[model samples]
Target: MTANASRAISWGEASARRMERQFLARPAGRGTRVAEVVAAMLGAHAQVLSAAEVSVGVRAAGVTRADVRAALWDDRSLVKTFGPRGTVHLLPAAELPLWCAALTAIPTGPSPFPPDVRVTEEQAAQIVAAIGEALDGVCLTVEELGQEVVARTGPWAGDLVMPAFQDLWPRWRQVLHRAGQSGALCFGPNRGRKVTYTRPPAFDPGPVPEEAALRELARRYLRAYGPATPQHFAKWLAAPAGWAALLFRELAEAGAVEEVAFEGSGAWVAAGDTEFPGGRVRGVRLLPYFDAYAIAARPRESLFPGEAYRRALAGGQAGNFPVLLVDGVVAGVWHQRRQGRRTTVTVELIGRRLTARQERELGEQVERVGDVLETKAQLVVGKVTVGPHA
Candidate 1:
């Protein structure tokens, strides 16, 4: 019924439109700024520092690694925190209040742990509070913070250890994400070689009702990766499908978004943002692992056709190796090896060939990648074996 308001948009058209929305088409050139780029992408993945830097560099033209670092550590304009899917991401610090409020609003259900490892609601609250209090004015390493948490909340917070990935982890560590989502904790600049944590004062505009927060998040997600189904939003945010579907309905009712047909399946886009012009996507790119642009796109089949998805994404996991993009589709997988000042970028075209011009552009992109890393890059075009992310 909602689709009646908008015509069907082909996958090709959608891809081109995404390139524009994602800044892949226009990019944040010299005139544009890094804040705008970060806001547009929603957030840049920062699990791999270099990957995050390259992600920002690609979109925010002429931005150096130092610029990004200053944004995070010095200027504090961008906050490094655990975001979407509980992954490290760089978010505009000014938007932290809204993001924190929205993310905390999502109901995480009851604790799934067995009694032996389960933390009571009261204990969890105390642990979260202790983490906040401990890092109010100073940063502390994980171990140091653990000690502070135990001092504040008592030994129960530290004594409880649960099995996690072959190693045992403190029960209170489970609430680290909750602390970040609550806006009471964030990443501090590394002290020498050790990671540290701090509590950045955030503006809490009182209580942001769940409905309001969900609506805002939904709107942003659509703007960043529109022509997407509610399922995609749910998957991206790790929210319940039924809950996401309900929010979409509310968004449609309020005229905040419009429904479009994506390959005959229903999709939603921010109202008045359904334009998908032809012949927009051009050139080649080397998108680093877990690049926000690559991670946010949905309907995997449309973005990665044939065996491309299987090769790039294994068992539904993305970011094994840097992806090679021809136009807007995944053309191959690539790996980068750096030693001293030289970086080697190895490309493996998976049954896809490029035009001479594209090859040149790819080479230029390799150079740019090197610049992002401050290294001299040597590109190797050959057969690259694909496998799981290390």
Candidate 2:
């Protein structure tokens, strides 16, 4: 059959189904540690207690701290999922290696700053070496490591270390891989046993060719969020458009991915034609900031409403409120407040008033958020109200 004919399924239906399957697929003994569940569902972004707001989102999704813990430390569900900016997501364990490979391969854009301000290839290599040495047989906080890096790299390096490092962060996986190779770093507790990072313990030095990594990333993208365009992948990876297209083509030629048409948009999917889980949409959701669900798609406007999208992308500085999803569409915005002990949640509807059912569903979610925070919560329906008690 032609590619267009092969992918005639409804996109909305597919997305909803995927959500349901993933949400309900929790194992029998899963614990509710928000970090673990976030990692499992989203990938590498998981960590205990750290990024508390994100943890709140996981809880709002009906996952508990115990569930998250079980998923990570027990079920080993943390893996890597690729999306915007080639960032590694904390996906389930089984999916980790594949996602890692994919992100490692994608080519990135040139530094936005001038070459003098940027880390040169030689400087990057030196920084990597310094980091490896500093981290050898020990875990250091960012502050501590900064000191060590500055000490080792010398005064001449000045503050150039951090700027250069931040710029080179897009390629951090490469340095991490090398550190793992040299026994300088391995996966270990970070941020007070809440997170994991490459630190000395069980570092491996296996070979990972560049071409192979890129191809694998392409395959995983198609498998998880496919029937998408090369531009989508490029936007997601924050990589050069031409390189992303080339990588997509390579994967398609290898039979790892297939070009498919969804609506009028040409997209790609995993060769196996695996379907999403939710199987047609239903209830609303409150997605957290920087959530993969928000970052994974491209031309993001297509997924959320215009006003809501602007608020969300504005980095929250412009009173851009938290989002409220109704049947997979951006329906409104919401916020939370904490005082002494009580917690209050306020939701602002943008268009149609929330139906009784939507209000009840939202209330249930608000309570779930309270349960995760171990605080008493009250839901207040309104528009743009702020205070410790709203």
Candidate 3:
């Protein structure tokens, strides 16, 4: 932290700077390689497969949905699995070991399930191991794999049912990501209509010390989204506050990161990354639901000013709505629905209107979005409606 420096950047300005670092602004994302773009952004949110493709396509020049699919399924350059915050994400295949080592190290918070239904640590470990064994060099649907797990672990692994998504979910399903984080599983191509899982060929889990992994994760987070507070890092990673603070302090002492002032509060940025180019970022983009730009940013109040937060987020969840970005700040919420060969994109602008150039750019962006789905898009600008995407 060059604490004595006399520049206090506003949150809006800080966001614009992040846009450049995030590859959402000028010069655009440089590489044709999707892995490079995913690595730069840390990871691409993959809760919605199509949305994840659009996220990467927008950043990388001339990339498309098929390109991303090929990377995941055919070329095996990428893998879709559970990532930070226990959310689905697309990560570069080679970096899986590092991410898995670091992620598996974080202690899981207290169980959400009742004691009667919760799996014990020993049971959970057994289930994880069974999943690894079942999926080795093979693909199986969730139901098919359940039988395998029960055969290896026990009937208890498949017996407990807990409340989730307004329905009863198998207790053993909880360790799905635990298996992924242990280098035991990854998504495979769909079998007709069912999603399947498989093990990465030749993968042998290497020991990555917990503290070293945490330090590396912290360094990568700052490099990608710096000028951030430890609280921001904690919130984004779903890590405990005390642990994040101690980790930040360790990084600061090592000179890997430094503290800086932002609007009267202290925040940390990667060392040697304090310079901010002068001026607002100029662009109009339609970032999809769960796009890393919206999901990973902190101080949501600044990112979604006015009533925009209520409209873009639901019950404190990011990615509930697609976002319209004007100069790197949330301008509105949008929805895209497709039928047959056409897709309708409806954008409800809040208190602001676009200039002629911005409107034209938005049209081009709409075209790009349609290309991702292989459908013709018809854009509709309706009377402003302030609500979350449905």
Q: Give the per-residue lDDT digits (tens) of candidate 2, residues 228-340.
A: 77887777666788887887787778888776666566777778674544244777676544444545543356556667665444642211345677776667767777786
Model 2 accuracy (lDDT, Cα): 0.54
Clashes of each: 0, 42, 2
Question: Residue 204 in candidate 3 has what lDDT?
Answer: 41
Candidate 3's error at 217, in angstroms?
Answer: 1.2
Better of 1 and 2 by TM-score: 1
| Model 3: how far residue 255 lies from native, Å | 2.2
TM-score of each: 0.94, 0.74, 0.94
lDDT tens per residue, model 1, 199-233: 97556467667678778888888877888888898
Which segments of candidate 2 are over 4 A away from where they belong?
A: 1-7, 24-62, 66-101, 160-205, 274-279, 315-321, 385-390
State the displacement of the C-alpha of residue 120, model 3, in Å, after optimal TM-score superposition: 1.7
Off by over 4 Å in 1: 1-5, 109-112, 204-207
lDDT of 1: 0.81
lDDT of 3 by residue, 1-390 (tens): 223335876675677777777678853544558887888788898878989998888777667888889889888889998888887899988888788888988878888887988999999899989999999879999999999999998888887587878887677898888887777888888899789998865544676677788888888887677778888888887878887888888888899888777767898888877777566678888899789989777678777878778777888787888889888778888888889989989887877889999999889888888887778988898743545545
Cα deviation of 138, candidate 3, in Å = 0.5
